[model samples]
Target: MSFFSKLFGGDKEAEKTALDLFKGLFGENAKKDDKPEDKPEETAQEDNTSAPADTGADTVSSGPSGDSWGDDMPAEDNQYRHEGAFWLYFEGIFDIEFAEYRYEKQVLTPFKRIVYTFYSGETKVLAVELMSERCSAYKFRNDCKKAGLAYTRFYIDHSGWWNTRSYVVRRMKEALN
Candidate 1:
């Protein structure tokens, strides 16, 4: 079902039931404000002034650069798929890009889904919609479990998810080769 349909489908009862189950199992409050206000917010800031500057300008960092949509660096696990094609993993803000594919509408699906298609001059890539916010990670994991597709985590709150698809296209050389 489409996201809008699921959202406005008047199935609040089921959603509530699921939320209750999650709350019971993880002790996670369905609503953030439900937590006691006793925990004080930490205003601590780390002093990075002493940190050494990066000396390697030639090295490409693994995050979005310029206007490109995928990472310049292919994934470390190269044997699974896209032996030569560039790989980009999206996480956090990158998930926002996947929202485009969630709807059955005018926009094209994300390129990361079926990146192998690019190897043969096919630009189309399949995108699977994640139904639940709480389960998106699990859903994406399960989706990748069914073979022929590659999977990589974006690693939010850490380092990962490089964006630069245009670089991938250039590297692929479909326009010149």
Candidate 2:
């Protein structure tokens, strides 16, 4: 099998192994099917689950638009909900020393937004932002370029679900080198 196929699970057995890994990490949240037979249904489910939660009236809102970090936000605000999957899939491929979340304050806007920085030893090798459906990653990409930093956006299932881990690993390796 091609390396891509092996990395991404070319056959049923390989696919089953990958699914098992995901299930071990995410439990019931990990999908069981190896095929895209129900992509539309999965997409709908993802859309509902991936959105930021409503804070209601009692709590102050915080995000790009709100005053506080917002409710149910990840420790790394820029981190996509599925980043743990990415880490689980790719950590074996790279010797990542550490990952950190950073905030960039917009001069024009009142919000301070988070972005991810990955380090290999002391060198900052990559910056990543996880974008939701309504958000675009262009600005983050541009910022990375201007700062001479390697960067990429991690979108949920940008490729097919089964292929995304391998695709992201390829992209990160390319960027790191």
Candidate 3:
């Protein structure tokens, strides 16, 4: 094990030398095997059972689904086109905070944008704040309806005024959709 132990004809070193000698005599690429530190690298075929992946640009398509992008937005939609930006934002919150919302479940979260919420077991809830007076509460409510989450509003006064608004959403129907 130790250098001193090996120098004194240790059993471990004797075993290693015998193995090396045998490998040198009959192993494939024996000349390469002379360097004891080197190991035979696995070919790609040996490493993966699946066929080689196609990486051509023409072959690959982008979106929420690798088959196509987000199904919510179509490929030809003018307002919501497939931009790489959405994927980056999607990947950022996915698994870390919003693992519940995935393709199979058909759940969406407001993580990258306004509110942050997801299905907690059976109940759907969201943590949302009204940032501006101009922002429509109805639009926010409809968004929550679309996602099947309860719409709970938390307001904070950032206009240097003293009116601060905050509350936890406890009601199933009133607070959420």
| Candidate closer to the true structure by TM-score (higher is better), 2 or 3 | 2
Q: Which ten residues in a row have the lowest lDDT in candidate 2?
A: 38-47
Candidate 2: the clashing residue pairs are 61-68, 62-68
Quick one: ranking by TM-score, best first? 2, 3, 1
What's the C-alpha lDDT at position 68 in model 1?
Answer: 27
lDDT of 2 at 70: 29
Candidates in order have lDDT scores of: 0.29, 0.41, 0.33
- Which numbered prediction scores highest in TM-score against the true structure? 2
Q: lDDT order of candidates, best first? A: 2, 3, 1
lDDT of 2 by residue, 148-167 (tens): 89976544332112223344
lDDT (0-100) at residue 12 of candidate 2?
Answer: 58
User: For residues 111-154, could you state the per-residue lDDT of candidate 3 as single tens digits?
Assistant: 11245455566555654432222244467668777976555542
Candidate 3: deviation at residue 60, Å? 62
lDDT of 1 by residue, 1-177 (tens): 644337547566555644443443345432335332221110101111232232222223355332221222222211112111122222222234343332221212221122122122343334322122222345554664574433333211111222233332233233223
lDDT of 3 at 80: 14
> Which residue pairs overlap in candidate 3's backbone?
63-69, 150-176, 150-177, 151-176
